[model samples]
Target: MKCVVSGGNIKILARAIQMLSKIGEEMFVQPQEDSLSFRSVNGSNSSFADITFHENYFSYYAYEDLDESDSLKCKILIRSALTVFKIPSLINKQIETCHIQLDANSTNLCFILKYKNNIIKTHLLPILDCETIRANYKKEGTVNHLCIQPRVLNDVVQNFQQNLLEITIEVLKDKILLRNYIDETSNLSNETRTQLVFGMGEFDEYKINSNTTITFCLKELRAILHFAEILAQPIHIHFDCAGRPIVFICKTLGVESNLVLATLNPDDDLGSQSTTHTRPNSVLKNSAKKPTKAKGKIKSLSKTVFGKLANKYPTNTNTEKIESSDKISNASETSSPNNNNKFNATNSPRVNSAKVIASNSNTNKRENDNSSKQNAFSSLLKRKSNQEIHSPDGGDKDDLVQNSPPKQPSKKAKLIFKKCFQTTFNPESLPGYNNIEVEDSGESD
Candidate 1:
């Protein structure tokens, strides 16, 4: 039966076969097909050749001119080549198993390529499939012609290239994952942006990414790269988590870079510790102990000795002391008998002296007492005088009511009135009234 296979390059097919061998397959190559309509020639049998051509000057001609072993080997080589070159397409097609069979008679050679469950299967070829070959030949002069085009081959190669690109992306992803892993494993706390210092000098800090001298393992290098890639910004490194500086930078202020050197030595003493203008040793020593009074002992001694001496003297004298007997003697001498006798004789009383003295004293006392009483009375009278002088006119009526005795109305008033009156008359014409008026008028005329 006749068959066609198109678009397979011999070079590509050879490379595919070599690759298949690496994956544990054995294959043998046959001579390239020409213009001949070859027929099979077994010792006593004849068979027609199975002839096929691919798109790229590639042909496969199988016939009984060779032994059965050679035919089977040829089939194996062809299948192997197809598999390697069409790997991408096969994967895409999800074909898994492939089977091949070939048969040879003296005048004809027949081959069948069958798929099991649409999966590619593998085996040595050149097995007889007489019934299938006859059926194929009767229907059409050829059976199962498969063609491969340049475009199709290019598409398969492109698919493989795309897969390779995907693998590269996965690798990059894994690198990022590894970087994060290293960071987590390092267990370093977050470093702050600012640094604080108590002293003066250069500070010792870690160089996260900028120090060329500091060798980084794969993990750390990946971490730094990942940080730069993802954050797209620079990060600062401090001395430690607390962010204190070991030594202050002498140059530009507030400029922080990742470059780091050695730690500042404790002995560097750049004099920042003297900011308070105090001696370091003195300050430290004073802080170490409790304060005490410098003259405590002197104060206690003075108090004890002077306090005792002051208490002994009445006037709290610190220098002089007198005995009790001496004080008593001085008191007696001041009150001697002779002095007392003289005082008594000079002050002897005369006759009635006591009375006179008593009278004079009494008189003086009485005068004083009188003067005092008069003064008191005068003050009382002056107070009353002031009241009378300053009082209103109606005050006399109040005084009358207070001082005068109340009187009853007398009945003699009516009797006297009755006796004295001659009549109760109105004097309409008086004797001198008209005469006085006329005389006054005559004088005026």
Candidate 2:
């Protein structure tokens, strides 16, 4: 058997095979006198899928060598088939036609895909001698029928809570309900369950031969939903009762796919036996609010300090304090009076030490300026000495090197305050205006 497929049809066929692979690990490929067929049943026998393509579906169909009653069948791994069509862009673009040939006597199937620019790819897959599956399921007496657009039904199902194991579909007078099928044996209250309900107006056509409700596994239905590509069109659904597989059929302009989802049996008498008993803690848990943690807390650099007054510190103070925090100590600064006088050149130099620490912004800025100037002067003097050393005669090099003063000690920054004062102070510097109040003493007359 040989045939060719190209254009968007390639994507349609590949997506179909990928979908079928989800229902089962392997597939049965059968080519007859008029059309080709694909079928599979899951390991649990709970679900089955079958798809067919007639001669008209292909651009060029020819199987004249085989009789109408003859059937050529083969079994191939799902992964092997999926890999060949994995690149979707190739299908909708430059691909010309894909040629497939089934070998009856050989042990493998050959697939040759031709593309533009003379590019060609050929793959061989080993075939297994597995029997074709023929599922016997009756659909004549189905009581409930619903024709729904894929988009509308998808919008409703997406709202259901994700943790549900199964979904229960119920049909009533003019409305339908899709809800989480909580096991009656689990003792879960109905209030804790999530339900999605819609009126008959949502469906294109709704019919019921008799009132019916069915429950089925949610995962299998979701696996089938991967073919939302075909769901742009409407999907037809029909089922008989509980514990029987429901039928889902989606047909596009070119191809059609059919899926059967097995229903779960309801527990017997479990709900009736627990109607009178109530778990008190369960009620409280159901009504309680769920706790949520904030992702991150915002941090502010400025801190409020409580002293004689409540005040916020400035950002510059915090920056310097943070930068110099690792190197603040008495040993970090020299107590030499000459060095202090040199730094404070405008002030008098003395044999005594200078121990004044910078407490405010003004003092800190002034001290930082003085320290920068002293360092710049030293650097300038050293540069001049190096120039003299490099001179033709190199005069007075020894004197210049010996006269340079020693490097100044590292600068120290402190955050302490010696005093605090507020309000107006008189020109006489009144004691009442100061933080430290002076005691009044009078001589006895």
The best candidate in terms of lDDT: 2
Residues 116-175, candidate 1: write the lDDT tens digits.
Answer: 355443433432222110000111111111112223222222332221211000011111
lDDT for predicted candidate 1 compared with the true structure: 0.23
Off by over 4 Å in 2: 67-71, 139-141, 161-165, 183-192, 267-445
Question: 291-352 in candidate 2: lDDT tens per residue?
Answer: 00000000000010011001111111112211111122132234333322211221122111
Off by over 4 Å in 1: 1-9, 26-56, 59-445
Root-mean-square deviation of every model = 62.2, 35.4
Q: lDDT per model, in order? A: 0.23, 0.53
Would you estimate the TM-scores of all the predictions?
Answer: 0.13, 0.56
